[model samples]
Target: MLTFDIENFPGYPQGIGGPEMMVQLREQAERFGLEVHDKNVEKVDVSNRPFSKSGLKEKNISLRP
Candidate 1:
């Protein structure tokens, strides 16, 4: 699994929407033979060392400290 911690630039400051930025990122990733998963995170569990996040599409991702 690959994750990108991109900077979120709000509004059209540079003539790009938030979703459009994600789309561009996905496209760029695909150009490099990377598979992108379009998932919107709905829940996050950061109470412990190993954090877990779940997406609205039923994807459960984990992060270890």
Candidate 2:
């Protein structure tokens, strides 16, 4: 587990803890309609795939979009 001090973050006069800071950041992102998909990306193959109206073809971009 990685950890760090968040003394410079806003709304934490006494300096928020590392985990607490992460939670706060997540909440803020959610509030702003940011999609957060927690998953591990394995591979990506952009060849001979279908393309949308923009003509962008991607075979297998193994990410959470």
Judging by TM-score against the true structure, name the best candidate: 2
> 1-65, model 2: which lDDT tens digit per residue?
15677677578888877987788889998998876656444444445354211213423333222
Q: Which stretches in model 1 have alpha-carbon errors above 4 Å?
A: 1-38
Tell me which residue pairs clash in candidate 2: none
Across residues 1-65, which tens digit of lDDT does each residue of candidate 1 receive?
13334345555454555566777778887898775555787888999868998887586777654
lDDT of each: 0.68, 0.59
Question: What TM-score would you give candidate 2 relative to the actual structure?
Answer: 0.52
Where does model 2 exceed 4 Å of error?
A: 43-65
RMSD, every candidate, angstroms: 8.5, 8.1
Estimated TM-score for each candidate = 0.36, 0.52
